[model samples]
Target: MRLEPDVILANRLADAAGEVIRPYFRQLTSVEAKPDRSPVTAADTAAEEVMRRILKQDRPADGVIGEELGFERLGAGRIWVLDPIDGTRAFIAGRPIFGTLIALVVDGQPVLGVIDQPISGERWIGQIGSWPSTTLNGRRVQVRPCRALAEAHLATTSPMLFSRSGHAAFARIARASRDTILGGDCHNYAMLASGQLDLVMEEGLKVHDWAALVPVVAGAGGVMTDWRGQPLRLGAMGAVLAAGDARVHAEALERI
Candidate 1:
């Protein structure tokens, strides 16, 4: 079956989201706290709205699960999972590390993904199956090789997002790694796909936060799975572990 149309639509969704987000990046005067205490801004809401509108018009049969918006057509065979502004805290701080995450998940598995950093003009696209390579701005990119966890550079969004046990598990992996970066949100995975980072582990991710990352990381020759070493899907637990090298991932999983 042809996937070009789906790929085209995914890019369009990312483009639309970026346009809506750029204006509100640092111009938002107020940030509202969701009941879950996560931050949301006008940019986040507006971006998701625009993407949803486009999907409604162009791919009415596809489902949508978006941050800043609610689920729609959940039982559809294909769903677009969106996190319009993945790093809201960084965006509100005037940082350009935030990104728009778009993923096309068929059934429960993500088959195509896009990560767009609008301010930096960087976009990574990853699609599974026969078209397996990941690309950054149309150029092919792959993960760097790291044979051992001790040689790996690790990263996570925040230690606070981890539970007591999850934090302890991450702490073990961090202690075993060469270094750890504290923040970058979804951008961390993009960097990993570009060979700039080796591993990223985090907890408390929703489906929209991680769905796009699987294809990106996997297409770059990396492995991304839950702490239990199982593949991520629509209903998997939120703990995430990604490594550019399979051996490093296995070692890290053992530690967890």
Candidate 2:
């Protein structure tokens, strides 16, 4: 497989972030609450800083949308989205599931993405077009099929993030699926991409939260959509679903 400039740079971006985030996990680091009451930490800011500095030097003309720093030069044809520590709560608690997310969106679509777990040194790389599908480390990976909801292994971060209107839809899926686990954050999506998870549904996501996930899941032969079963974009309404099998994704969409 040929490596594009975005893919090569995205790998380095994740590495730079990991270097900054590793020293803070499980250690006494400053944790602060955002205006919205979400928890953030020095690690989150520091990691994003590292990534942003690299992007400025390497992809200077490209735009950036970062979780900690907000948007910059965002109208450019190619934009980089960064979520340095996707599961900040998990990171704070020393859960290895937390990941650094980086995505390159060009012409409004994500063409390249990386999900990196700094502690474990595990990276999932995904890209658009017709070549390599997806990979964990250096090996190929793909999502598994589950035709029926009764056979699905569903996962989510939490029901607490579900919107009031989305609750019944979520309940229906939870009742139908064979198993469900809460609080995997982006790890659940990575697992779904690797065929270990059959389905993942979540609400209340920002673009930075789910942008990288689109290619990761799709390149692995899965489907990711909004609650209405449409493709994801930068300004989506936050309700999202990812499924390994095409049939199951359609079935879940109908139920939602």
Over the stretch 1-256, how does candidate 1's per-residue lDDT look in tens digits?
A: 4668988998998889888888886788999999999999988999999999999999899999998889999999999999999999999999999999999999899989999999999999987763347999999999988999999999998999999999999999999999999999999999999999999999999999999999999988889999999999999988999999999999999999
Q: Which run of 10 residues does model 2 get worst, by summed lDDT?
A: 125-134
State TM-scores per candidate.
0.98, 0.97
Off by over 4 Å in 2: 1-3
Q: Taking the tens digit of each residue's C-alpha lDDT, what string does model 2 give over 62-169? A: 999999999999789889999999998999888999999999888788877789999998999887664347899978999987879889999999898888878889
**Candidate 1 Cα misplacement greater than 4 A, ranges:** 130-132
State how far residue 43 of model 2 sits from its true place (Å): 0.5
Clashing pairs in 2: none
Number of the top-ranking candidate, with lDDT as the measure: 1
lDDT values, one for every candidate? 0.92, 0.89
- Look at candidate 1 and give me any clashing residue pairs: none
Q: Count the backbone clashes (under 3 Å) in each candidate.
A: 0, 0
Note each model's CA RMSD in angstroms. Answer: 1.0, 1.4
